[model samples]
Target: MHKASSDTLRVSVVVPVYNRPSELRELLAALVLQSVDSAEFEVLICDDGSTVDLRAVVDEFNTMNSLQIHYFRQHNQGPGIARNLGLHNAGGAIVAFTDSDCIPEPEWLSELIGPIETSSVGMTGGLVDFRTADHLSGRCVNYLMSSMLGAGGARDPRAALHMRYYPRAGNTAVRRELACAAGGFSGQRHGEDIEFSNRILQMRTKIEFVPTAVVVHNEKKNSRQVAMEAFQKGTARIRLAREQGVHELIHTLPALLVVGLTASALTGLFLPAFSKIAGIPTVLYAIVLALIGLHGGFLLKDVRALLLLPFYASLMHIGYGAGYLYAFLTDPSTSVSLERQTVAAKSPHDGMSEQ
Candidate 1:
């Protein structure tokens, strides 16, 4: 709550990435250009298991940079593992995180670190923007892609509750001590951010979202690959819910809604040709499909995106719901022990009701 100096170099930027060489290059470039003082912080690019060699990019960046950027290559562990490694190596007072596909604004570090300047704070996240690319197809894709985001637009009315305005891994930061105290990230499957925050919350540390600290995210979508990612995200989200110990209903609720909506949409898609013509319900289904499609349509372009909206929605819902079911069946409540700390809960779905 106290205003702190924005130019402080107390923040450490941690970026966990996979085999996206191009995206990694883009993000590294962004890191070098940060407005925060180069001397105050260090950049850790933890490569999970890049298929291609990245030393070229790092070598090129170090040639003219004042910031000390270190590259760590680990076995093909998930992002969770990579981030944990970054946390272990980071020396900054504050820890900031972003993904390889995102471009943080010059003020990102300053803005994110500003709030955590208070001693009581533990974590903070910033606004994540799904900006449009210059191509016309890209514009359509952006709008369609982000349409499902009325969910993102819905801010927590409770100012005391941690903000989900931009609850994304690509644009979040946490204090190093708090993160270490909470158990450094590797406890989850997909939603490392959610799981990481859970440990912080358990420690009674304050986590906040600052909309002003923005990052322009490059939403990756090849026209042909949209449906597959949609399905994978759904599945990943369910696995994420289990990882964070968030109730399946709470974590997988969006997927459920999509399923319900998709069934209704499919019914409408099929009814248009029926003799009885269940016109009203079909129209209602159309409305639902259009609404949900608005989200995907903006994410994609042409007929494939539009034609596959219901399919993608179904894939996401079914995929996530199934994953949650599987995790629930196998390890309803699992613990991830690290060092002396153990991140586990018996029910994993209890608590937070009173929150």
Candidate 2:
């Protein structure tokens, strides 16, 4: 690709990295091959206290590619803080956000930035495709994400025309000025992107969802990893609801059903009449699981994945339910402060790789 004029750098792609050096390298490699002019865009790697020095990686890419690559290091803050730092230091007119683990397509930047450059929209988001659809756990995660059944509700872009939808930071672009005015990203351990997008929307800025600008996200979570992620996501959802009062009924439905079934089952132990009532929620849960399995199987084209769907789905529901219940029992008045305290205590994870 030809280089653009140095005076007209149009886009700056900011990525947050924790400890995934190989993934970061892969993402940078794909970025260097973008269809847009190398000089038109820059890549900023915000290192969040990774054990290894990433400056070497950034310098190596800078030496080989025509595109400008910059690196910034910070304490063990979360991706939100890292992104804010990048935004503060960015020199381009538009800021694109993606994860260290995502590989953007050749025209990803060009397509994502088109609407903002050509239309009144201030921000644009694209689709994220899994690199491989062969793994059962991976397929299950993708299914939940697409359906917005669990933590996926926060990142779902397939909302009704009248409903509000937010673009995920993993594959989104925004005008620098609008992003700055929106206060960039909140420094929460999770749900920071959703909060930021909502702030932008509240400002009356237009946001567009572009399916053509795709990125490949390599998800290789096993059953245990999926379970942990589900639990963490559930916790984050409750925290988000408590902080923003944005309750997603769809996401909470499964958890509520699970809770109801458990409560009924427990009451049945004491009262014979409640025994029969307990079966109702169980039957309903089975039907939901069946539908989820059937849909996942159809999408993955693998009946084997369907066989494992119920187990994974159950884990997700239980984890989310537990988190919701925990948050509900705790004092809502102190949730915001508690959330910040929790984030301060925990180290930043590879936020970009999450669903």
Candidate 3:
């Protein structure tokens, strides 16, 4: 994923911003200096109804004439809908997406679009590295949900997905046509990217990995934020699980609980080696249980925060469980609706269209 700055690439950068004022400002600053030719690119910044005044944030980038940058304000409809609106307003054949909290490398867009142009792939995604340990837990949870959420994963998690790739909605690109054809992000608050990726994979669309298209996800060091994030993520996971018809996520808790209890009970009666091994997972399981018991209300993913690795994973399981229960009781059907209006294309489907 070498940078392609020689030729001008017209990219419609879509960023969905919320209340994060300072971060958004930093992101805009980074966008201002991208290795891609600013003159050839356009930016559509959708304000996802921030409670705070973000005018200054947008103002920092809006005054620039080097690139066409515009701002749209929408009531909080969650990030999915916010991004979908940006998708509708984009003007470049190549649509690049990133979160407001993310800081893109100078070559971010160039590298992402470069591979897609060369390979003629319909869409692509990139890797996200957290900035600090204060975000380790939330960051780790992001890793766990990556595969299930269509955010892209290492051939193995142990592989760390560090090898360069694409498919994640955040920090990724799509052929404007492909996004338009499949419909845009669902209005749901969560798992919209998962649904979109599943649609692409189901269609056997060619998606490539551009390892060089990297972004630093400045993860939340705040537990409350992490907790709320977890809750929302839980809500989304449940919705997506039903959508995918995968019910195992819903039952993971009871099953894990049973495993924990059974392992605890059986450990004392088993031979030494077997007993220790049985106790290990059980001990880890109990650690998760204890964390939730102690700080179930908190949200940050850092060590001092409420969600630890095992506990955060467990909380996610709980959220999915509760989400599944609610969905099953409400709508048992996970069928995709044909009525889903395809996202109206604001630009040509250069990257997503068949060459």
| Top lDDT prediction, candidate number | 2
- Of candidates 2 and 1, the better by lDDT: 2
TM-score of 1: 0.71
Winning candidate number (TM-score): 2
lDDT of 1 by residue, 166-276 (tens): 245677788776777666765345555665666677787787878778776675555445544445445545554544544433445555554555566676677666423
Ten contiguous residues with the weakest lDDT in model 1: 346-355
The collision pairs in model 2 are none
lDDT digits (tens) for residues 76-170 of candidate 3? 88777777777776667778998877888888988988876777687887766542322465455554444322122321132433222226667
Per-residue CA lDDT of model 2 for 237-342, tens digit only, reads: 7777777765666656646866788787887787878688767778877887787778767776778867777778777777767766666667545666422211
Off by over 4 Å in 1: 1-9, 133-166, 187-189, 222-245, 248-285, 292-355
Q: Report the Cα lDDT for residue 222, model 3.
A: 45
Per-prediction TM-score to the true structure, in the order listed = 0.71, 0.85, 0.71
Q: How should the candidates be ordered by TM-score, best one leading?
A: 2, 1, 3
